[model samples]
Target: MDQYAVFGNPISHSKSPAIHTMFAKQTQQAMEYGVIEAPLDGFEKAVGEFIHRGGQGANVTLPFKQQAFALADQLSEAARLAEAVNTLSFNKGRIYGDNTDGKGLVADLKLQGVTLTDARILLLGAGGAARGVIAPLLSELPASIHVANRTEQRAVELAVQNPSSKLVASGLDNIEGEFDLVINASSASLAGSVPSIRGPLVADAVCYDMVYAATVTPFNLWARQQGASRTIDGLGMLVCQAAESFAIWRGVRPDVNPVMQFLRAQMTQSL
Candidate 1:
């Protein structure tokens, strides 16, 4: 079987192994997928050893996405634009990197029947997670996009990175105006807290929390309390992104709906 894995620090909680295992079974691919917890300061060393052991590819998470980007011998447009890489394929002594997060988000949104064209978008947080998805969202040609962060300068910096007249930046405290789509790309949801912001912003808008829990995320709950039209968590995004990575490695696209439904059922039962 070909070897594949996901690498990260604090990787014990990762769902990548299970997700990929399901995909492998569904596609009847002869592959073994697992998780590797690399030491914080030794990500490169771990990757080198994995490649030495005939590892075929890897899914990178958390702090290592940027490092994976730097380690790539070649990058896809998605990886280059995001300045981060979440999927890596090794071939003929070279590593190819790509970012599937943005494509995953867009795919999930489309599956949910959310329209992006000519709508206003509010992106919370300007960090890697936010950066990875901005270009893809922009491709959907929203009327405008506003990136808000705790630090005003980071938001400004992110907006400037893409250099779009349709994009704007603001501090979280000063966020105003109605947004047809509000996406929480911040780490706040991991802490069971919503990103601090004033609203009227989420009112009647579709809200997406890029974090998923067995139940609704705190950000989505807050959006619901604020009378948002719809709220979605990141489970579908996770499955879609994993599917993209599988396609990259195996050259075949597997259906994501079944995997997503299976995972959702598991989450429900675990509760």
Candidate 2:
């Protein structure tokens, strides 16, 4: 089997192995996927060892995506804009990096029947997760994109880095207007917290939380309570992004719908 794995500091909870294993089986590809827990400070060493062991590709998660970006021999355009890498393809001693998170999120949103064209978007958080999605979202030609963060300056910096006449930044508490779409890319949801943005969300707005759990995320729950027309979790994005990485490694794209259905059933069973 061609070896592949996902590398992260706290990796035991990752679903990449199961997701990629299913992709391999369905595509009739001879590959093995697993998880590698790199020590917090040992990401480079861990990647080196994986390469030495003939690992052909890997997914990167949390606290290490930026480091993986730095380690890449070359980067896809999305990775270059995001300045973060979630997928790495090892080719003849060269490591190529790409960011599939934004692609996945956009794909999932389209699947959910959310339109991005000329939409007003509110992105919550100024972290790497938020950064990873901005470029892809911009490609959709949204009317405007407002980034809100607890630390106002970080939001300003991120917007400046990806300057756009349509893009603006604000403190979460001072979010001035409603939006057609609201995306939660903050770690706040992982901590069971919501971004400090209070609303009047746009009429019939769609809300998305990039963090997923067995139940609705705190952010999504709050959005629903605030009358969002629809709320989506991160599971679909996760599956779609993994499919993109699979394609990157195996040169074939697996159907994401079946994998998403299977994963949802699995999550339900576990709950």
Candidate 3:
């Protein structure tokens, strides 16, 4: 059986194993996927052993994304641009890395009826997650894209490297104007918090939280009250990203819509 695993500290909460298992069963692909509760200092060793043990590929998460990015033999353009690697494919003694988070966000937005083509975009946060998605988001050619972070310098630095699009950096408080789409990529949402940007920042916008819970996340709740036209959590994005990795490793793109709906229903029922 082909082997795979997801690496993280508190990985007990991760849904990647179950997700990949579903992908495998749905496609009739023979594979074993599990979780690796890596020690804070042992990500490299854990990944090395997995590849050695016939592990075909692995998903990197949390504090190890930078380490995975540095350890890869090569990177996909998306991974290189983001300086982070969330997915690693081992082949012929070489490891190829790619960050599927951005791809997942874009595809999830499409499923939610939020079109980025020619629309104005407002991306919150300038951290690794934000960096991972910006390059792919720019590929969609939104009319304009603004990156606002609590730490202004970080936002400025991220904007300088990504000058291909009409990118601008601003402090969260200085965020002005409206956007057709707003993505809350900051882990703040996962921490049960939302950014402190003006409520008007989400006025008339379609808000997306990159973190999902059994119920709507704090970010989506705040966004909805700010006149957001639509609000969604990250369950769809998580499934979409997992499907992308499945397609990369197995060459079969499972219809994620059904899986997404299933997960949403499960979450709703649990609440």
Candidate 4:
């Protein structure tokens, strides 16, 4: 059986193993997925050991993404753009890196019937999560993407780095103009808080929080309270990204709907 795992610090809470296991079973692939809680300073060593042990590929999470990017022998366009690697494949003594986060996000949005063509998007936060999705989001021909961060300079820097006329940056307090979609990529939701943006930004707009929980995420709940047209959490993104990685490793895509339904049921049961 092919061996795969997700590497991260404090990885015990990750659902990647379950997601990939379902993908493998659905696709009839002979593989086993697990988690590896690598030490913060020993990520590279851990990856080397995994490769030596005949590990086929691995998913990366949190603080290890950048390290994975640096460790790869080559990078996919998405990974190059994001400067992070969430998926890694090993073959012929080469490590290939890819970033499926943005693709997963876009796919989930489309699946949920959210329009992206010529839409105005407001992306909260300028961190890695935000950076990983901007390129993919731009590919959909959105009219514009306004990146807002707590630190104005960081948002400005991120915008400058991406360098697209359709992209703009601002501090949360200075956000202006209405958006067709509002995405919370900030860590606020992890703390059970919503971003500090004005509620009007979400009024009649679809709100997406890149954080998921047993119930509605804090950002999604707040968006609903503010009259958001619809709200989506990151659970779909997680499953979709895992499916992408599974396809990369197995050369076969698994049906996501049944897996999504299963995970949703599990979340509800945990509540």
lDDT of each: 0.93, 0.92, 0.90, 0.92
How far off is residue 165 in model 3, in Å? Answer: 4.3
> In the order shown, what is each candidate's alpha-carbon RMSD?
1.1, 1.2, 1.1, 0.9
Deviation from truth (RMSD, Å), model 2: 1.2
Which residue runs does candidate 1 get wrong by more than 4 Å? none
- Please name the candidate that would achieve the greatest lDDT relative to the true structure: 1
Rate residue 237 of model 3 by lDDT: 87
Model 4, position 17, has a per-residue lDDT of: 88
How does candidate 2 score on lDDT?
0.92
- The digit string of per-residue lDDT tens for model 3 on 67-119 reads 99999999999998899999999999999999999999999888888889988
- Per-residue lDDT tens digits of candidate 2, residues 18-97? 99989988999999999999999999999999999999999999879999999999999999988999999999999999
What TM-score should be assigned to candidate 1? 0.97
lDDT of 2 at 50: 97
**lDDT for 22 (candidate 2):** 90
Residue pairs with clashing backbones, model 2:
none
Q: How many residue pairs clash in each candidate?
A: 0, 0, 0, 0
Task: Tell me the deviation in Å of residue 248 in model 4.
Answer: 1.2
